[model samples]
Target: MSEVITGGCLCGAVRYRCTAAPNNVGLCQCERCQRQSGSAFLMATVFARDAVEFERGELKVFAAFDDDGQGLYRHFCPTCGSAVMITLDRYPEIRSIMGGTLDDKSWLKPTYSLWTSSGQPWLVLPPGIRLHPDYPDGAVA
Candidate 1:
């Protein structure tokens, strides 16, 4: 089995573990993502919904729709207001963990970047990472 990945909210009020390897690790620079993260972009690591197991505390969720009108749910720590995870109605089988919430982020390497059209002009990405003006042509997320 792959090594278990563990993470939690900034306040330590919510904790979780992932047993499966990530399906995708990407950066999102959409306007909504920028606002949600309060940064240039959000680093998200995706895995199967069943792979993530919450070990402690409850998450407060904010539900909204994307620019395309797809349902989006943002889960966070109510105590510290740290975004922890997100779920999409269009991809119910998948869950995305906010990379910053992970206890160990040394292994987190974003392979793709989305919404480059809305990405911050001053931001620079590492070489060879795929860039998409919007969601990748065949990507489900």
Candidate 2:
């Protein structure tokens, strides 16, 4: 089995652990993601919600609608102001961990990229990963 992925916020106010290996990892260049991450793009990893647990700190959320008008919830650390995770409020069974929060970033390379149309020219994506101008079919996987 893959070793559990564990991490926390900058101030340790929020901590999380996921027993399931990430089924997908990718970068998102949607405007909201760009703004929230305060960078060129937002990197993310998907895991089953049943596989993740919050050891401490409550998650603070900002509700927003995604491209499909789904109820998207952006969660972060209240103390450190660090982006933590995001999820669809209606489906709590699947969860995403903000890639920036991983304890060991070496293994968190993105395998795909989404919303590339909104991606800035200043940012250069890594070579050899699938790039989707928008969400692909079965994107939830």
Candidate 3:
């Protein structure tokens, strides 16, 4: 069996577990991601939708649409307002966990970065990782 991954919100109001390994892990520097994260970028760990289970608390969802009219749902802890997860209409089968929320982050190694066009001018990307101005061909945002 795959090792389970666990994480939660800042106030401990929300917790979750992933039953399988992540499908992908990447950084997003899109304007929406930067604004939502209050940072230069958002590190997202992608997993199969069915693999994630909310173990405690409830998440308040904020839904927004992309320029293409696709849905982008941001799920956060209401108590602490910590962005915990994201779901996209463009990739219905995946759930993206906020990498900063992971209880154990020592294992994370992002392989690519998306929306580099919007990335901060002073921020230097990791060495040798794939970089995309937008979403990679057929990959999640």
TM-score of each: 0.94, 0.91, 0.95
Q: What is the Cα-based lDDT of residue 27 in candidate 3? A: 95
lDDT of 3 by residue, 19-87 (tens): 999988899999999999999999999999999999999999999997899999999999999999999
**Top-TM-score candidate index:** 3
Q: Which residue runs of candidate 1 sit more than 4 Å off their true CA positions? A: 67-69
Ranking by TM-score: 3, 1, 2
Lowest lDDT 10-mer window, candidate 2?
132-141
> What's the lDDT for candidate 2?
0.85
Candidate 1, overall lDDT? 0.91
Q: Enumerate residue pairs that collide in model 2.
A: none
- Candidate with top lDDT is 3
Model 1 C-alpha lDDT per residue in residues 1-141, reported as the tens digit of each score: 239999999888899999998898999999989999999998889999999999999999999986689899999899999999989987899999999998888888889999999999999999989999998866745
- Give the clash count for model 2: 0
Stretches of candidate 3 off by over 4 Å are: none
RMSD of each: 1.7, 2.0, 1.5
